[model samples]
Target: MIISVDHGNKSIKTPHLLFTSGLVESENQPGIKTDCIFWDGKYYSLTEKRISYLRDKTEDDRFFVLTLFAIAKELEYAGIKEPDDTVDVTLLIGLPPAHYGQLHARFEQYFLRKREVVDFEYNGRYYSIRIGKVVSYTQALAAAVTRFGELKKHASSYIIDIGGYTVDVLKLRYGKPDLAVVESFEQGVITLYNSIFSQCNSQYALHLEDCDIDEVIKGEPTILPGEVQILIRKMASQFLTEFCNFLGERSIDLKVSKCVFAGGGSLLLRQIIERSDKVGFPIFIEDIHANAVGYDLLYKSEVAAHGGQ
Candidate 1:
């Protein structure tokens, strides 16, 4: 079976499952645990016992646990008998454009052709699977390929991926990643939310969780009051203003290539970008799923191109 996993700083996204990128350390495993995994010198909780994971999870062994958990959850959802099944698996993941080259070999060494036992319970079901091969792609490029598919007519593109933690821009030339202009901006959607959360907590004494803030960002009425809503919008405006200033300082040549906006964070900034005449009508695709969808598509294409080699 082939699977793709994206360990975004704020969330873990796969073609099958999406969960908060949070892990908790827990001991006291006396009487048989239900949904925990022991891997690479750490005990991790698969379900509720989580603190937000913000660092480079891919560099450590937690990536495997997350992948196994995603596969197990997907199998449970698919009604497959998964306990003790040593299924062959091909794992695909992505990285930022700037780090893709330096980390490519490291990630490949860390994940490729690995056989490890993953025992976990997902959705009231038990599962065990042996991991097989692992592969990776550049995040922004994968998103662009996913957006354009095989029929992409453009020869070059500037992929502006506004993700949860970082906004990465990759310059693609002649249908390949041009690493020279790859840039990563610290401003992202989480920055906007974090600003709002901190402001609300300081001003209104409202301690809202990340999930609640996400709901509000999606235009849901969270009983958070119109006053808070106004305040958050103000914060968003300031964030946009600052982002615009950052863009101005960078002096990106928008005319050099077609701009494609992608990632979950893109949805919030799409209109702002459209309104500003700076970006030249940036194209927006399936923001949240573009990278994973692209990874899946790439996996299929690779398999077909290689004749399942």
Candidate 2:
């Protein structure tokens, strides 16, 4: 089976499942073993506390372990329960457009293991699977793959992926990326989170997490003080303004180009982004799993072109 994964700094996503990028490892299984996976004598569980940004995700096995979790979740979603046979899994993954050139090859090699088959346990069920080909694609543009027919009508379009740790911008002229203009900026939603946390701590003497601020932005009823919620909305708007300025400094005039927004941050700040005058009316890819879904689509096209490679 071909399974695609979009490993974001804030979350890990598959076509059927999405979870935090956070991982908790333990030598022994915990008493409350919800969402636990056991592999190589170690226990791993998903957590909301995401890891710090890493320039190279292949530097450690953390991401690899997370990939295993993703695969297990995909299998579970497909109703492939504790089968006796070993399943071959061809994983389709992706990296930001800016990182594609330098890291794509390494990222593919990182998932290849010496052993032909591996066994792991998830939620008390065993899974035996072999890792086949690991394919990597560019991130920002991947989410826009399915809409190329529509995008081709435009002379120029921009895919602005507002992710957890980086805002990846890809300029596509006539539905294909202009490689020279593919860029990733460190100013992502995480920066806004940090800024909000700092300001809230100093002003209101209350520290806040992303979830707290998210509630405020979504206009969801919560226990937070109204003043704090107001501050969050205010800062979120300012963040969008600063983001527009950052893009402007790079000569990216969103006003002149058709823009498509993707990733979790874009969805969270949908209203705020729509309210910004810096951009023309933009199309937001509300599905957080768009990248993963795109990866699957791209992989299928590749396979068909190559005659079922």
lDDT of 2 by residue, 43-146 (tens): 99888999898879998889989999999989988989898899999999999888889999899988877537879898899999998788899898889896
TM-score of each: 0.82, 0.97
Candidate 1 lDDT over residue span 1-309, tens digit each = 777777676667776677766665455342455555554445566553233434355556666566667776656567676455566667788888777777776776666535665555443455566566777888877888875653266677778888787888887775567767787777777777778878999999998776666555567668778888778767766676677567657766553447788887777666556666556647887657678778888888888999988
Per-model lDDT: 0.69, 0.89
Q: What is the lDDT of candidate 1?
A: 0.69
Provide the lDDT at 287 for model 1: 51
- The 10-residue segment of model 2 with minimum total lDDT is 109-118
Looking at model 1, the pairs that clash are none
lDDT score for candidate 2 against the true structure: 0.89
Each prediction's number of clashing residue pairs: 0, 0
Name the top lDDT candidate: 2
Candidate 1: how many backbone clashes?
A: 0
Flag regions of model 1 displaced more than 4 Å: 28-55, 58-61, 112-114, 149-151, 173-176, 253-257, 274-278
